[model samples]
Target: MPDGCCSHCSDFGLVCTYVQPQRKRGPKNITIEELSKENASLKAENTSLKVKLLSLSLCSLCSRPLQSLSAQANSSSVFHRSTPESATTPPSPESPEEPPDEQDFTGDDLAERFGSFSIDSLKTKHFGSASTFALANNTLAMKENFLGRPLLIQSRRPLYWDVLPWEKEASNQGSDHVLKFPATDLIAALLDLYFTNVHPTIPILHRPSFERSVAEDLHWRDVEFGALVLSVLAIASRYSHDPRVFLDGEGSLSAGWKFAKQVLTIRQLSEPTIHKVQMYLLLTLYALGTSVPQLSWLFLGVGIRCLQQHGEFRRKPGAHKPAPEEEVWKRAFWSYVVLDRTNCVFLGRPMGLQVEDYDVDFPLEVDDEYWDWGFTQPLGKPSHMSYLVLHVRLCEILGGAMRRLYSSKKAKILMGWDGPEWEQHAVAELDSAMNDYVDSIPPHLRWDPQNLPQGTFFDQSAILHITYNHILIVIHRPYIQKNERPKGPVAFHLCTGGTRHHSHREYVVL
Candidate 1:
């Protein structure tokens, strides 16, 4: 219409012929250019989607699957970006170590799987069972996640001093129904038994000072310290054969429970002290001895946190200069560690404390008398003190194994291992460590039925032997599922050896 293109053709009047010219096409390059623009847009959109997914994965609270995918994608990108020579070459053995990392808590793997944030996963995955999250946070908190991870028990807006129902039985000090104290004679007997039996194994308290406090009723003045005194009496009563040792028509079990309730009344006191720590430990021990392991394990966590608050693990160097208080605290901390590991093993739970977190020294192997005199006596290789030291060392190893092999994070990682060979290797290493621990025991402490020592020394020997076997069983238990161990050989050697070293009568007595 405008220039060369024909709109219409007409010949003059009649009999005119018309013809259409061949059409000319535009360049094909324009079409290809349009297609290229669309392709670039699509690639950009796909890349944005992938980036979004990776970001979401990074910020996710507990999306394990997404995190794994993101990690794989990232590692792949890193691998592809490497130079051809580096990609083809194997890692050199002489490459510098990465400054000896304390632990590997990479983004993909978090070590604290049972901290405050894990309550939901715990309830969902574990069902009705008590998970480590539940134990660390209160079991009540697990049920009601909104309650949050509070250390003390709560009743409405403020935490109540007395959390347990039984604690209400205690009356105001000046009230008509004031709580009564145990008789002096009963107190004397219980203290005697405690010093004679329990103190040898766990010498956290100084005997003379404790006795003075008890004689003067000094501890009874403060509610928290009073609870500690009551707990000690209650624990000591367990070793007593006489019913009269338990005051107010209470049995040994009831005595402990009554004191436990009193302790609960002061459980949430704003300040934590050494006496309070001791009270919690005694309560845990009492619970364990009575076969209430759940309660024991729970209280063990409480004690551990309390100890941490007191900075027992973070001792001030030279602050308590020349005083044996430092030594006492060290022993107390290790005592808690041993009890913590023991309870965890019994309950099949992860440990609340880790050895790497502690920076305290082990108590010196010396007589308790020397501690009272602010000096340490030279120790023989195979003395009672040596046995105590050896027990702590072995307990540390047991705790390490529990952490390495039984932790939630570690278990999750190992479940993805290529084969069962890794598990076998881990179990074998633990087995060797345990054997070495036993072999390190001095000759005199080692059990001998034929030439057994007199009194409690012989009893300690038998207990040690039984304890060693118990730990062995604990370490090797997972292997039972796959029939990786010959239970008969292990059982036969330990059981028969222990029996030969300590009579069947002794086993019954225990």
Candidate 2:
């Protein structure tokens, strides 16, 4: 029996038998050679068990069952397990190696690559919402703080000198005719000069005398001058660090606004001519509204009065041939509408007009001969002046509605407005208007060089005839707000030269 037990113990090994004592125990003292042999055999058995457990652990499909094996191996003193499957899997293949030499990631590359990255990836990882991403990344990068500013949908053709009728003449005349005291340049120069002389931070352009000369004699009737003023005001409002330039206290802007009001009051402006002036006035008021709310209110009041007075005049008996005063008043009314509409919606105020009330009568009729000029021909004798006024008023109302929707108390404090909803609504309305305007202007009108004026409009009738179509285009384009993004050199040219010029005059806000 002892001989049989001793043989069984030898086969099983002393360590295994010691753990299960009823099976049998090994010899208490043994030769060193025998002990070393036993240790070697135990180590070899432990290593084999460890390898099997590791293989099971690495197989995700079998990992849960492998836990039991791991416990068994641990009991047998085998803890070192191999993860050969995981190690050999090779990091999920490393995204299929990009071409080593390809580098330039242009917009097209970003569109293609990021476009495929999955919106879920963007929302969960990169950007939050589409609107938030667009606002922070694209709009902020373009330096547009105004929420109402339009985004360029696609790359556009550059504004070239050849696009304008006067470009050839201006180029041939060199700097003398092109740059010399043109009414538009003059007003821009004056504003630059005024800002430079008064404000320490603002830089003065090189030709101070030339600029002053242009401003002093600037033709208020010139449509290009109007465009120039709008552009300058838009930029100045956006970039100017000094709020005092436009604010009431001691700045030249207050005086400038007063002066503009005087000019409008003194001059008996024709309809077409006043359209240009009104456009500038509206844009200037918008810029001023950013810094001075009260001043803007004052301007708003003036605009309302102008509209009311004009409405009364139109109602007066037998005013058949639209008097020049009537035209000026009509222009002022529309100017007010545009300015108020923009401010009311953007600044979170109640809308002042209704959509139904937009229809009003005008003395002038649409010339079917100029239908090719790119403006929407009214179905009837649709009052061009009245249409503009009503359009602006409706925009204001929509802006107010939007402001009510997204507005919060915290946002109001930050923006110095009643709510943010109005701004959002206004932005949507403006964007819509821009689209409508772009659509309204026919493709043929864009290429019509003869449609532009020769010089200044000395005769009111000629000016009215020449500018009637273009005024509609200007109102629709709102170029300053529309073409704002810097899209290379070409965008710069269109942005600077796209609109007709107007005289430097104070715009009354009411």
Candidate 3:
């Protein structure tokens, strides 16, 4: 009945039609009512997602007080959830809320409770957008520049002794006290001490000129006051075993204290003076050796600075001199050589003797004969005899002091030898040479100690003799057996002469 024609009707050759009732027409487009329902459902889902994100952002320990947004905000929660429309939108005043208490979380309280909010974190939070973080850090660093200030501040305790009272007083006192003394007078005094006390054996041709200048300058001081000041400061800062004395205490201004202070004050007067002051300070530090332990670092710093500055100065165009200034340069040249040699021995460096390092150069034509032989002569030479006697006495004193201060083995090693046996042999050789030289010298010349020639010729000749003796001994060292033939020709020659003098008598053993 529902089809267009039934099979029975088609067999009877009659057409039949059947039509089903037409279905009601569906809506052509989505209805506003249905869309409104869908939109409400979507809003509910979005709200649920936003609430989940807010909960995660509040942090796992949200029940506890929060210190930072970054520490709590979960990145995954934030990225997945759509931001609430009202999230970035400012709150209206109509929506009332309790005002946050300013004193609720002090820095200490936050640090104690949160434990993660460091000064750096707080700084980042406060200065997050600022580009001057580096400048601020540098300023903070400067405030902590004192030796142990940072450690003291961090630990909340005194790390070292307080500044001495006398030092504080000295600091307060104006340079007026120092300015009272003429700079020229101070310079003269230093020069006088240097000439009289140090390397006196070395001739100073400029002495007369220096003396005349000092006399003429009545107001002009001889020493570089600035240099003297620097020297004193360097010594006090580093070399004094008891710096508290000079620092601000009762021990201040003791003889040694005054001398050190005076020297330093004079040294600080100018840049040119600094070099001299530094040089002297370094020398004194080396001379003092480990006697002043605190000064070791100071000495190292000064020594390095001096070397660097001097090297740079030498590189300057006109710092180097020609043969014309030989006589004038000789004093400085020899002093530099002595200083370099002494430095090598004291500092255990491989530095050698040279004039260029001292900012001077000797003429090539000046015969080595004119150089002081006091440090170079062998004991048997007349020129070496007096010098050797002085050296032996000094060595004896040094040896005794060393033995008292160090282990016997250490003392021997320090004196440039491996063991006591070597030291003994060296001492004996020096003694024998001196004795031979003294004996060989006519009794009249040997007897007169006060009127000994103070000339450069004698000094230079003595140095040559010793240098030659040293060279010979070094060259023959491997070949010569202990107590066999002395390594040097000077000793052999002297012994041969002694044998000739007493042909019948057997040569006396040392």
Q: Give per-residue CA lDDT, model 2, range 1-510, as digits (tens).
A: 354345667677643333433656676787999989999999999988865653331211111110111111111111123333423322113122233212222222222322322211121122212333333343232322232343223322234211344544443331121211223543455466444432111111112322443455442333234333433343343334444334466554343342233223332222122223333444345446345554555545544543432332222222133233333344454445555555564455654543334333332222322223422445654322333433443444344444433457676667665533554454456446554644553232222334532221112213222233323232333233434343234323433333332111111100
User: What TM-score does each of the candidates earn?
Assistant: 0.59, 0.26, 0.30
lDDT of 2 at 296: 59
lDDT per residue (tens digit) for residues 1-510 in model 3: 435767777778777654455589997688899899999999999988865653332221112232343333221110122223413433224322344333222222333333332232231121111224323333333333422243121221222323356654554443233422324544455455544433233332234433443466422243443333333333333323444324355443331344454543432322222234234544454335345534434444454443333232121122222221233333333333344433333443433322233232222222223233312334444442234333332333323222322335564467556654564465466546545544554432332335534443344334433432332233233333445444345446544554443332222210
Question: Which candidate leads in TM-score?
Answer: 1
Off by over 4 Å in 1: 1-179, 245-255, 315-322, 378-383, 409-419, 481-509
- When 1 and 3 are scored with TM-score, the better candidate is 1
Taking all chains together, the TM-score of candidate 1 against the true structure is: 0.59
Off by over 4 Å in 3: 1-205, 216-223, 226-258, 264-270, 273-334, 352-360, 363-456, 463-510
- lDDT of model number 1: 0.58
Give residue 105's lDDT in candidate 2 (0 to 100). 22
In model 3, the worst 10-residue window by lDDT is 73-82
lDDT of each: 0.58, 0.36, 0.37
